[model samples]
Target: MIRTLAFLVLLAGPAMAQDPAEAAQTAAARLDSAATMLAEARSGEARVDALTETVRAYEDGLSALRQGLRQAAIRQRQIELDFDARSGEVSRLLGVLSTLSAAPTPLLMLHPSGATGTARSGMILSDVTPALQAEAEELRARLEELALLQSLQENAAETLEEGLAGAQEARAALSEAIGERTDLPRRFVEDRVSMAALVASSDTLQGFASGLAMTVAADGEAPPPDASAFRGELPLPVDGTILRRYGETDAAGIERPGWVLATRPRALVTAPAAATIRYTGPLLDYGNVVIVEPAPDTLFVFAGLSETYGRAGEVVPQGAPLGLMGGETGEVQAILSESAEGVDAPRSETLYVEVREGQDTADPASWFSAEMRSTQ
Candidate 1:
């Protein structure tokens, strides 16, 4: 029975020694795919679309990597705790095995009882041996897994650095493409003088929006596309968590009629629907803002961007890049540490979304899809 147990242990050891870096490997594969996309974007005819996809790929790959690292850290901690809890039992088991291995075959076969008693001892050994072997195999597997998690963390630094660089490049390319883009339809020519005067006169977002609603399009210009069909189905313009719901008071104890989203640094912001850019620039207390008229008498206001894109009066398609959120991306070490600590990616920027119909503000939550909000 002892010999059989030892043989089983040997067999299980080799099989259980397989790498436990499956999560890390999957994340690395995603990063590699993103790199391939980046290469294709360089020469793609539709640079804007290509670069946009590339950026999303990088974001997904990095998110996967962070999650994998977090899981690994958790698994490693669990294994360590298990080992600590069973250290005494493991030591005693090892000592017993060592003594048995050193004993002569004749002595090992001899029991302190007669033949009938020896048979009973053999019966007990038969049941206990398999359980001991299984325990040994589990311990070995956990040890191997712990080692692998450490190795993955050490090697992931380079992969993360490269992914971050590629994402930055993709974003820069997308920005340049949008700036050079002239194919989008025009609804009107923005009167800079009028816009400037409105900005100077308006002290609140509602006031500004109301002023914008009164601006007329140039004669013969096309009307803004109808986005009413997309009501209750439009996706949020950016990937993020809803930090503050409509009418929720912020840290400053002031309430707003909009949804504030918390997003990662430099995350992409896109148009939720096909719309004409009514305004795109800094406004009072809001950073860079983009106000798009998605339908007649309806406007979607996006505020708090680091950099805005598209000229006012240009009609852009849905999912068109609007701007980027502010703040610098975290370094590899900081990201790894945060992952190891099992925390979410830092959302260092905020985007405020407001829906205005004529002069009254409507809840953005009603306009955006419920599923989209839950997922984000």
Candidate 2:
């Protein structure tokens, strides 16, 4: 955990652009806080809770590292501009020093005319030299800063690779812990043949959603958990920043009415609240979509997952492992803030979440915790 924290701190160094040095220091302090929890967890007491917290810490740290890397690239360009601006000052300082060094001390003392002239010349040089020296020191400081910035960028890049690997390992451990437990009562079992036919006939997501709702109701199974109790209090399925919020327009010129979360590659996903899996499979352009119902008139749609768990009939408690994002390196090249065009490299993995009440779209932001809402 300490190793993970260290790499994260290195990656966070560049983001505090106002004070990169201070940012690094702050990151270290934050890591210390995380480390304290890890040490307490090592006592073997509350192993499950400890492991879960550990995974969350690593996930948070990995997110910080990614943000730092993006800032580092911008800082590098700023440093180049600063170096260019200081070049003339550095050259002038060097010229002044070269001129002073050419003459011997004895010659400077005994000027061409007399002692009076020598004294006057000495006074002028003494006064001018200090100013020149000050300029030189300022230039040197900027040069040092440039070097430090370069080092920070290099270290962040290397640490990012290591952090991704460590984070993924921790995610796998958490997944196993979550998958082992499934105590939610089963409500209904989906018939594959019927579901396939319903899916084939439905022309839109809304149509499919409406049909699924009616099917669950007809089964006369016990109602799923009352997720309304968690309105604005539920946690996200994965630890990440909301890249795009409900009703936000993306660069593709399409307005999205769901929450889009940018997560690490292969990151484990969980059920935000207790729900029965209504449907789980590929849909249109959504990649792999999972529809879960936590209560009557409340259906949660999770899309863009690469691997899914549980069939259409299983009930999962809040926080149960659901699926994972795709990709090997866990690195994304573009975000919702940027256009996908010209991005030949693999983009970041995203999870699209839509909360629905009947046929109307509900704002997902109102379904998450207060702390998470602040992040959005």
Which candidate number maximizes lDDT?
Answer: 1
lDDT (tens digit, per residue) of candidate 2 on 291-310: 89887778899999997766
Q: On residues 147-228, what C-alpha lDDT tens digit does candidate 1 reach at each position?
A: 7767767766777787788779878888888878766678887777888889989899889988874554463266669889
Which segments of candidate 2 are over 4 A away from where they belong?
1-56, 98-110, 153-158, 182-204, 211-279, 283-285, 294-296, 309-321, 328-347, 365-376
RMSD of each: 7.5, 6.1
lDDT of 1 at 57: 58
Worst 10 residues of 1 by lDDT: 1-10
Backbone clashes under 3 angstroms, per model: 0, 1
Instruction: Rate residue 110 of model 1 by lDDT.
Output: 67
Q: After superposition, how far is residue 204 of candidate 1 from its true place, in Å?
A: 2.1
Off by over 4 Å in 1: 1-45, 100-106, 213-223, 373-376
